[model samples]
Target: MNLEHFDAIYQRAAERKGGELALESMLSTPLTQQELLSITDDRWLSAFSMKVFQSGMSWKVVRNKWPNFEELFFGFKIGPLLMLSDEQWEAKSIDKRIIRHHSKVMSIAANAQMIYEAGIKHGSFAQMVAQWPSDDITGLWLYLKKHGQRLGGNTGPYALRQMGVDTFILSQDVEAYLRSYKIIEGGRDTKRSLAQCNQAFSFWQQQSGRSLTHISQIIAFSCGDNRM
Candidate 1:
């Protein structure tokens, strides 16, 4: 269901309520800026995913930005991602609804080269990530490329970072994907930290003796055909 796609952000939502609960269940955690950038010739979809998270957007991330971001990243030219100029960031910082941190704005502009380079270096960025381990961002990149809603191609990389997608070489969306899969059932998983949310999913594995795909079936029902 659509909830699986939301697995990454649900943890942040949980934190606003801050209560004592088990934390050992943290399955995946957010990566550092350095770690996010450390990703090498990995997921192209992630690169594009980041592009969708533009530094100057009304929408905060991949969800709504996908349609617009998709339209912008066309043909892997990094056109949209590269287009962000320094002036834009300065103007956007005061934006109330958006994540206006300057670091995020600068990162979006700077990441264009990396995203474009990765695609050229690997021949097919999607294939490059798909070749990597499933738990890594590569898997998320490929899966989203293959399955997520095809927006008009306008994801803002800047917003993507805020939303928790790894902006690096497609190595960070891993936890997000894991979280999405866990979101199939939004109980304890929804209340935990990003790490804890992921942990709950793994716990479910042990308790239910099922795989992510199985959980997805229930998630599909929960989402009423994955609308939200």
Candidate 2:
């Protein structure tokens, strides 16, 4: 990766109002799977509560009910969550209560239990969330089979996409870094690593024995800035 090019991209994003607003908006926004792992507090409850809440409800309704959730869930404490049983789940699952669905409400309780059990193996709830299995595999080969074992849990790729999007400043640097290179339309895919792409680029440059910059300019000229 060209660090200079990457830095320039970041500089540009830093100059954009969309980038600035994205940063501010995502600050208190609910965290993603990756964010959940990175965080060690009841923020998980807070974030997941909102997520589970919205599973069947509209964002607007959930938004309105958010304060109620915070008050009802006690900021997502694991101990308090564990204390909540199937009956308690049903009781608080009242339509007026913050959570509603029986299955989903039961899931919240079950997921908390699951998280707690996972913590036993990983030493902490954060580690359990951090260690959740992913569906994509990573490897030197480009084929899906080679890298399909998936790393970083089933949500790794999803997290990567979120990490690259500048809709939230949560991933501005990532978006900027990738945009700095000729990564093409798609962002730096999890299946394809920078190291692997760099290796390919170096091999291709040597075989072609020509600077890619010149080749690109020539192609751009032939295609025209408007059409290619």
Candidate 3:
């Protein structure tokens, strides 16, 4: 595919966002691999659960009730959550302290089980994530979608990004840029489209020496109506 140079994209984003300094200030960096390794499995579970609950609901509402989620879910500790009986989980669904969505609430245990198994296999879920190859980030997304509940599509990627994984989100603007360039086609969830996105971002990363997070943000800011 004939992709534009990262420099041109960066320039476009800078101009749109009010010059280089302003755009640079807006870009975010992912945590270092070491920092990712330092995170515990429960925090990863919590991030995943938070994203799942926020999927179709108000983000501010989820954020406001996060503490209740933490408390009721036993601080999202993988072992404790995995051991909860069906009745116990059902109780959590009706609890007044949380969102009370039964399906989303039940997803907590399923995802917790997924995390526990991953921890057993990889020392910790964080190790698996920290050691995942950045160039093949789409593979990681696939893994989460396959193994975890309510983690398909952007849900898993958003959780990963929140927890400092060096992954790009196919947000509306990013998807628009990809579609406009013919870098990807059809739905973003398909393997072919996602692989194409990975290739495009990998190329830009090589060209710019920037993280996927930065490249993704620049692409969004360069196009779309997000500019100031």
Candidate 4:
């Protein structure tokens, strides 16, 4: 059931969305260099932390309390945040401002440390993300999972997408499309599923000269989901 080419995927998406213009609007666009440069390390940490907390929770709850989380984490400033003791983090975990998930609260602290290290080692976390090769975005996902805490699965990719990094998100519709094309197994979610999907995407990048973001959107669009 795979489309013959990228243009076929685009055409199916356009038809599914009612017209070409509508499908164009649904495509994910990466931010410009100036805009990406404007994003600070603190903000990057916040976005990562937010995505970690948003996992398996109501996004509305996360969004509603985001300002409070920002305030509590001291604007997610790496230096001051790295100074927090375990007791301090545990204390905040029980606070009423943000979600009270203790492990997720601790993930904020852990991820902040990861960000601080990335900044020191790579000039800045933003630089690492901006300069990472889009041709191997799965590597970025792997790095996040290994270096940062609790960033595995779709969370890492989704966060990258939110930050305007060129990456793909394997939503259900996208997974279905991948399975239809024999890119991934129809079996349960597994490490093999991720590896195969990543390989398939890298192959498509070589074949189409398009960003992972665009390819992922086209596949999801082909499924007629339209649910970002």
Candidate 5:
């Protein structure tokens, strides 16, 4: 399908945000591949767990209690986390220091196992993420969804973005923009729809010479009522 040039979208976003300078200031840059590589496995698990807990909950509350999560989970060290006994996990589910959600509490260990296996296969989970091609970020997202718990939909993508992986979040505004342009059709979570989005973002990246993160923000800013 044909798509509008990235310049036109940027112009609209710039107008909405006040000016080109203001729009540029609002866009965020993803970390470099080397920077992503330098991060350890534990940190990746921490990011994943945070996103999982933050889902359908107050981010501020999760952030406030994050230190306790780190302490209780042994800083999310993969080795120790993978070894927790059933009774130990049960105790953590009711711990007052955390949000007390049993299912989400269980996801921590499940995701840790996913990361541990990825580490064994790819030298480290960070290496696998660092080496993933930015052009095919959906593939990485699919991998997480298949291997980890509660990592489907935006959860996996959000976690990857938080951990410095170059990815575009399919937020409400972004989805609306894609549908308006006819760049995607039907269910947003379907593989076909995601592939369409990947193609559209790839085209925009080529036209703008920008990262997926920036392009995503531009699309969001260009639409909806986010005017500044």
Candidate 6:
């Protein structure tokens, strides 16, 4: 129930691994609210599309093919992406320029609309994402899943973190640590499990005044893994 217990675990793991945890080295890269709020629309779309294409696929493959994706999607410009006709997107299925997952390719349009609408309402899409309470990050995750295409489960949180938002990513190692503490029970991917983990993180955040990213990184380090 104490965050110090979690810190002890991370320290032991770091000692065993013969180096500081990744989070330790990231001290200078703290993600601030102002930084997140300043992110541009293109970056938001790129981050979202990266997470979407990365789902259930090799990250290396996605990275390798990203330049082509950028070209095909017009650098993920929201306006051009929205203006792309259905036939244009359908043609991408057969085009060698990008991954041919039909549903994922189609998601670009749906997600574009999601961002566009948010921008219309909030002055900018970044405002919407940046203004979300980091203490209730799961709420933002729910909104992304409900509003954006192909952004269910881990995609939203992963994308948000990549966009420099202060949020936890429930990776396997993080989930394993949560279970080890009995904070969550059963399989790690269930709604109930996530709720339990979120509550624990919320409590710990209040106590420690740490960002969710740092806390999640500490948990993963405690497990002696950092694949996320």
TM-score for each prediction?
A: 0.31, 0.44, 0.97, 0.90, 0.97, 0.88
Compared with the true structure, what per-residue lDDT tens digits does model 4 show for residues 1-228? 253577778788888888989987878788865677668888888889899989999888899999999899899998898888878988999999888999888888888888888889988888878878765677788889988888988888888889998888878898777777777775524667667777777777777788888889988888846556
Off by over 4 Å in 3: none
* Candidate 2 lDDT tens digits, 88-117: 767777847564666655655654555466
Least accurate 10 contiguous residues by lDDT in model 2 = 162-171
Local accuracy of candidate 6 as per-residue lDDT tens digits, 172-208:
8876677677777876656776677778888777765
Question: What ordering of candidates by TM-score runs from best to worst?
Answer: 3, 5, 4, 6, 2, 1
The true-structure Cα RMSD of candidate 2 reads 11.5
N/CA/C clash count, model 3: 0
For candidate 5, the per-residue lDDT at 161 reads 83
Look at candidate 4 and tell me the lDDT of residue 127: 80
Tens-digit per-residue lDDT, 114-147, candidate 3: 9889989999899999999888899999999899
- The TM-score between candidate 6 and the true structure equals 0.88
Residue 201 in candidate 1, Cα distance off native in Å: 11
Off by over 4 Å in 2: 1-38, 129-228
**Residue 29 alpha-carbon offset, candidate 5, angstroms:** 0.5
lDDT of 5 by residue, 11-120 (tens): 99999989999999998789998999899989988999999999999889999999999999999999998888999999999999988999999999999999899999
Off by over 4 Å in 6: 1-4, 19-23, 26-30, 186-192
The superposed Cα distance between candidate 5 and the true structure at residue 9, in angstroms, equals 0.4
Report the lDDT tens digits of candidate 1 across residue range 16-90: 324213221322233444444445322344454444444245444635544443343343345654666667556
Off by over 4 Å in 1: 1-77, 80-85, 88-99, 135-228
Quote model 2's TM-score: 0.44
